[model samples]
Target: MRFNIRITVSLKEGMLDPEARAIQGALKNLGFETTALSTSRLFHISLEALDREQAETLGLQMCERLLANPIIHRYSVEVLQ
Candidate 1:
């Protein structure tokens, strides 16, 4: 059997504001400078023990149900076949 597993990563946009600020402060402390900085969440997913086509469908369903909020932000999936 073949498998095409996709991993989707997402984050709350405004939720990262505070983290971004913290990163900026850390940078300042380290004497590293940047005009812009941002933060995001991460997710690692996999679909195994399935064939290529089924794995694709599973990845899509996972994205629609859990990986993406559908209200804010966008998501991308990467499949390893």
Candidate 2:
């Protein structure tokens, strides 16, 4: 079977997000009020798997092994048809 997987990766709390901060600053300078901001990455992958459980397992392994830094980042995986 084929699966559409989405992995969302983000920095853990207490980690500084300079790019997000910069964007927020720019927005505020442009007259948009903002309190806090953070940045994340989304990866959309299409791959073959035997079943939904296998697809979800593969997605998590992908995140743990390569997509996310376990120490500094937290990630979530979704399997979509």
Candidate 3:
């Protein structure tokens, strides 16, 4: 079966996001009011697996092994049909 997956990776709370900060600063300079900003990496991947369970398992493993840093980054995995 083929599956579509969305993996989102972002810094955990209390972790500084330099890119977000810079973007917020730029927005403010452009006369946009923003109280807070956060950024994340979103990956849309397509792959084939035997079943949904296996697909989910592989997705988790991928996140743990390479998609995210457990120490400072939080990630979410979604399997899209």
Candidate 4:
């Protein structure tokens, strides 16, 4: 079976996101009011798997192995068939 997965990786709470902050600052300068902002990376992957559970597990393994840094990053995985 083939499965499609979406993985989102982001900095953990209390971690500073320079890009988000810079963008927010720019927005403020442009008269856009923003109280908070953050950034994340989204990855779309398609692979072969036996089931949804297996696909989700593979997605998480990808995150743990290379996509996200355990100490500073967190990730979410969704299996889209």
Candidate 5:
């Protein structure tokens, strides 16, 4: 069996602001400060797995363990066979 999987991840709302401020502060400490700001990003993945169930399980794992933070973010997946 062949399975298709897609994963999408992104930063949570307030997460980005604090991260950006932290980066800006660190840059200032390094004497390399800039007015430029930081924003969030998205992670996208597409892969094929040998078994439908396995693929789905692995995809879910990826989301649960690595992709989504769970602290302030949510994720979804699509499995096709």
Candidate 6:
């Protein structure tokens, strides 16, 4: 079976996001007000799997092995159709 997955990676809480901060600053300069800002990365993956559970497991393994750093990054995996 073919599975589609969406993975979102982001910095852990208390981690500084320079890019988000910079963008928020820019927004402020443009007369926009923001209370907080954060950033994340989205990965869309297509692969073959035996079942939805297997697909989700693969997605998590991908995050653990390569996609995200356990110490500084957190990630979520969602299996789509």
Which number leads on TM-score?
6
Which of candidates 1 and 2 reaches a greater TM-score? 2
After best superposition, candidate 2 residue 32: deviation in angstroms? 1.0
Q: State each model's CA lDDT, in order.
A: 0.66, 0.94, 0.90, 0.96, 0.70, 0.97
Off by more than 4 A, model 6? none
Winner by lDDT between candidate 6 and candidate 5:
6
Q: Encode model 3's per-residue lDDT on 1-81: one tens digit a residue.
A: 999888899999999888899999999999999998999999898999888777788888898999899999998888897
Residue-wise C-alpha lDDT for candidate 2, range 29-68, written one tens digit per residue: 9999888888899999999999989999999999989999
Model 3: residues with Cα > 4 Å off, grouped in runs: none
Winner on lDDT (3 vs 4): 4
Clashing pairs in 4: none
- Expressed as tens digits, the lDDT of each residue in 10-48 for candidate 1 is 455555566677899999999998897875455555547
For all predicted structures, in order, the TM-scores are 0.60, 0.93, 0.93, 0.94, 0.46, 0.95
- How many residue pairs clash in model 4? 0
**What would the per-residue lDDT of candidate 4 be over residues 33-74, giving only the tens digit for each residue?**
999989999999999999999999999999999999989999
Off by over 4 Å in 5: 10-50
Q: After superposition, how far is residue 56 of candidate 3 from its true place, in Å?
A: 1.3
Worst 10 residues of 2 by lDDT: 32-41
Q: Report the C-alpha lDDT of model 5 over 1-81, residue by residue, as the tens digit.
A: 556676656566556567778889998999996986755444444566777777878887987987778887766666744
Give the residue spans of candidate 2 off by over 4 A.
Answer: none
